[model samples]
Target: MVHGGEEALMRQYAIGDEIGRGRFGTVRRCISNATGEALALKTTPKAPLRDPLDLALAEQEPKLHLLASSPPCSPHLVALHAAFDDADAVHLVVDLCAGGDLFTLLSARGGRLPEREAAGLAAQLASALAACHRRGVAHRDVKPDNLLFDAATGALKLADFGSAEWFGDGRRMSGLVGTPYYVAPEVVAGREYGEKVDVWSAGVVLYVMLSGTVPFYGATVPEIFEAVLRGNLRFPPRAFAGVSPEAKDLMRRMLCKDVSRRLSAEQVLRHPWIASCGSDAVAG
Candidate 1:
C-alpha cells in the first residue's frame, strides 16, 4: 500500500516494499500503472542536504547516472528509466534487477565462482568500465555489492553512481572513499589518483569471485588500511588451484600496487584471458 497522501502523487506507480537503503535514501519496488512493468524507485530526502558536501553528492548522483545511461547505452549498465522530484525528495526509477546483487549471489554459491564463469562476468564489467572511462567518467566504487543482474537475461549490470566523478585528460582526483576491501593503494595512501583506481577495484572483484576470499583482509579498519597500503597480494595455492594461469596474470596486472603499472580498462578487455574466452563468455 502507498503511504498516506502519496497515492495522488504516485498515481502512476504502485509502490511496493522497500528493496534497498543507503545513506541518502531508500529504494522501493514499484509497478507502472499503465503497463504494469516492474521498476526500482530510489527516493532521496531533500531535507538531508543541510551540509554543503551532502548537497553536492545529492546533485551529482543523478547527473552521473544520466550520463552513463545516455545515448549509445552500454548493455552492462543499469538503465535509468525516468526521474522526477517532489517537494520533499528526488526519485529515480530504474530497471528492476530481479536477480539481486553479486555479493548475495556469491555468498549463496559458497563464496566463489568457477574461473570460466568469473571470467565472463569480469569481461562484461570491464567493458562497462571502458565505456564509462571513454566518456570521462570514473566509477570510483566498483565492488560486488554494486553489481546487479537481470533475472530474465542473466546479464550483469553495474549499478550505483553515488561515488562516480567526471575527469578530464591528465586530471587526478583526491579522496578517501570507496569500500575498504576494493580501494586502491593510492586511495588508501590519500594520494591523487585517476581512473586506474576503478581497474584496481575491478581486479579485487575478480579475485574475490575466483577465490572466495579477499586479496587484502584484516580484523579492524586500521589493520585493513595497513594491509592495503602494504600491498601484499597473495593467491593461496588451495584457493587458486583450479584457476587458470591466464586469469591470474590478468589479476596481477590489474591489482598492481604501483598505479603506473596497472592495466587500463581497455587493456583489461584485451588481455589474453578475456580474448581467449570469446564473446560467449560474456553471454548473460
Candidate 2:
C-alpha cells in the first residue's frame, strides 16, 4: 500500500522498516526526527478512481479519527500527528503501538487471553466506547484486529473508523456499514440504527475476548449474517469457568437483538463487571 506521496511524509519520521498492512493500507515503523519518538505511519492511496466502497471507507476514516481525538475521556486513540493528500495517495502519521493489535497477541497465545488481562482490556474498550457515544460517535467496527495495545503502557486503543459515524442530535446516518460478523442484526436488516449498534459489536468483541471465538460464525458470510440475525448466541461453558458471571450477564444485556432493550454505554459502565474496573470509569 505504500505510494510515493506517502514517502515524503515517511521521510519526516525516518521510517526504518515495514510493520504490516491493514485493510486499506500499509503501516511502517519509524522514528520521529523532531522528537526522537518512535511511531507507525499508515498510508492509503487516494481515491481518484477507486471502488465505491473503498472511496466511502477512505472518506469515513479521518472523520472518525478527528472525533476520537476530540473526546478527553476516550482511551488513548491513535494520535493523528499529520496528514496530507498527494496527487496519488493519502498519508497519515499515527501513534505506533509496538505491542501490536489484539489479533496478533491472541494468535501468538493460541487464541485465548488470560481472564484478568482480557477483562482489563475490555474495561478500557468499554470506557473508550462510552466516551465516543457521549460525543455522538459510533465505532461501527469493534473487532480484535482494530484494538491496539501500546507496548509501553499496556493501554488499549480502538482503531479503524472506516464505518463509524456521528449520531448525536445534529448528526445521524442510515446505512448498512461494518464487518459482517460484528455488525448488529438491526443494521443487517436495513433498519435505521444509531449508536446501539456499537454496543452489539462491543458485546461480540467481549464474548470473543472471553471465549476465544465469536459467538456467531458460519462457513459463509451470508450464513454468518443469518446466524447473527437469528440471535444465535452461544458460549462455551468451560471456556468461561474463571470469569465472573456478571461479565457474561453484561454481554447478554449489551447483545440483545432489539436495540431498544440493549444497554447503553453508560449503563454498561455501571454494570458490576465494569464498576469493578474502577471508580472513575464512565458507564455507557
Candidate 3:
C-alpha cells in the first residue's frame, strides 16, 4: 500500500497548513515542487489504530481509492493522486478542493438548495456513487462532509473513502460503519446489504438539499435509528412547496424501505430529477 516511494513524498511536495480533519486523518494543503500546483495531503497517524479491524480499514483506503478511480473514473470523485507511508503515518495525496465541503455550504445557505441546483449536485453525487458501485465498492459514508467543491471550477467533488468497502462479485457487506444521519436502515439493523445502501444515504442527501431537513428525525442517536427503521417520510408543505413532484418521486424511490425495491445508483441517474440537469443526465 505504501507504493514504495515513502521518502520521495517530502521531496516532491511541501506540506502546508491544515485544511481539514476527520476520524482517521488531517487533510492539509500541499504544493507540488515541480508543477507549483496545490493539492491535498491526508495524514493518518499510525499510532492510535490499535484494533486490527481499524488497521485493516485504514490500509484499505488506498486500495479502495485505487479501485474506484480506475479508468472511466467519474469526474465527480476527488482524484487520489498518490499514497505512501512514512515512519509515523500513512499519507494520501489528493485533489485540493479549496472551496470547502457541502456541509459548510449548506450551513451558510440556510440548509437548503434551490431545486435546479440541488438537481445538478444530486446528479453529480449519483454519478460518483454509481462509479463506485461499478468498481465493486461502497461509499458507506455518503454524507455532506464528504462532498467538496473546487472554488475556481465551482464543481462538487466527492471525497473521504475511509469508510468505503469492496463488495465485488455481488458479495454482501455487513458493518456498523457510516454516520447516523446518512446511514441506511439495513445497515442500522446490522443486516447484510449491498451497494444500494449508498443510494439510501444519497436519498437522505437529496432530501436534505430539497427540504432543509433530514428525512429521519430524532433528538438523539437511538431516536434517529428508530426513525430510520420506521422509514416514514414527511415532506412538510413549507419545506417542499417549491419542489416538483418528479423530484419527490425520485426521493421516494431512493428512500424506499424495501432494499429490493430501492433504486440502484444507475437507476437513480435515470430518474427524472437527475434528468432535469438537461445534459447527460441519462448518460451511460
Specify the highest-TM-score model's number.
Answer: 3
Q: Kindly list the per-residue Cα lDDT of model 1 for residues 152-265, writing each as its tens digit.
A: 998899988878888867788887878898999999999998999999999999999999999999899888889989988889999998788899999999999988899999
Tens digits of lDDT, candidate 3, 1-284 = 35545577888899899989898779999999889999999988878888776777777898899789756778788878889866678788889999988889899999999888888888888888989998998999999999998878777788988888999987999978899989999999999999999999999999998888999999999999999999998899998998899898999999999999999988988886687652352233
- In the range 1-284, model 2's lDDT, one tens digit per residue, is 22246566756678778888866777877788889888777767765536776676675666666766653536546666666567766666677888789888888888777666666777777777877887778888888888888787778888766667878795656787888888899988887888888889888888887778888898998998899999977667787777677778888998899777899877876787777753342222
- lDDT of model 1 at position 22: 80
Query: Ranking under lDDT, best-scoring first?
Result: 3, 1, 2
Model 1, runs deviating above 4 Å: 1-12, 46-51
lDDT of candidates 1 onward, in order: 0.85, 0.75, 0.87
TM-score of each: 0.91, 0.88, 0.94
Arrange candidates by TM-score, descending: 3, 1, 2
Which candidate should be chosen as best, given lDDT against the real structure? 3
